[model samples]
Target: MKWMEKVEHMYDQFTVREQKILVTMVLVVVGFVFFMFAFFISDAFDERRERIRVLRETVTLLQKNRNLVQESRQAQASLELKAVQKPPMLQGHLDQIAKQYELSLNFTPQKPKDLGENQEYQVESVELKLHDAPIKNLMQFLDQIERGNYIMMITDIKLTTRRGQPDRMDPVLIVSSYYKRSAEELKALHDKAAEADKGKDKADMKESTKTTKDDL
Candidate 1:
């Protein structure tokens, strides 16, 4: 109270214009302090919003990765179920099915192929030629092969009707069966292939050297 009385006595000593100028200067300083407080509060709110946005994005990314992992696991499980421990004799299997359907067929066995980056599986395929076979019997033979206990699928089929007999067809079928391979088996196959490639490369080099010597 004593300080306020002294400030009033001092303000009464100044001219009206000076008093007005001092009051305006005080108001301006107060306004500047208020503006700075509001600016700091607004800046804090902006930082909080940015953090929330980043957290939401991280959660979304994690969920997507989880879904991808789940899908990969399911696909691997399905592949395991379908794959057999040993390769099936594709020609013999086809012959048995053809005999069951009372259809005569010729089989051409193809070379077995290793599949996948790790050589975890191998595929054995066979090509079958059926001449003048009844369509019904052929269909039954194909269905039996597809629905068999093994993982066999028809990769290709070409059917042509006999000149006059629409019910009889000459069909060529390509069937493939998948089987899993052990680590040792994969390594052996890899080594064999590598050796074969080395041999071929050596033969090619020898031939090239011979040709060059002959030219000289």
Candidate 2:
């Protein structure tokens, strides 16, 4: 407080030229501080503001998609239920479809792919190498496959004609099916099914034996 008063008294006692010089020095310092704030600090503040704006926009987009995300999860669970547990389980079913369409099937099934994201689920796919078939037969075969009881997807298909046999084209059809249970689990289930069948056969045999004695 006393230093402020001393500065005031000193400025009053200073000559005009000395006062002008002091004022200039004060103005220069003030200008330097203003430049620093406008160029450096303001720039930093602008970057911060822009980053915050982008984050707000991202949050808004995610909020808008919340319902869609929920719907997708529900749909995924239902689809998993319809997925096949093994590729071989569907081979006979596919043959029935081909027979219906009068189309011969030359299939090459790949090894089952382990989808580790779900402990109980896997993906099994087969590729059909077609030599030649009527256009109607081909369309019916594809339609039956897509509209099958199990949820299935055709990954790819490409047809090319041989130079000699322009009438016949070698078309490849890739079909993928999802497996609901792991291999180990399926094996256990299969053993149980076999035991049940064996028990049923034995019961039938015992019934036949009793009936033969009664008839005699």
Candidate with top TM-score is 2
TM-score of 2: 0.59
Runs in model 2 deviating more than 4 A are 1-4, 12-15, 34-78, 84-88, 117-119, 162-168, 182-216
Best by lDDT: 1
TM-score of 1: 0.56
Candidate 1 weakest ten by summed lDDT: 79-88
116-160 per-residue lDDT for model 2 (tens digits): 544456677888877677666777788778664466778889877
In terms of lDDT, model 1 sits at 0.88
Clash pairs, candidate 1, are none
Q: List candidate 1 segments past 4 Å from native.
A: 1-76, 194-216
lDDT of 1 by residue, 60-125 (tens): 998979988899999788768767545457787778778998999888888988789887778888
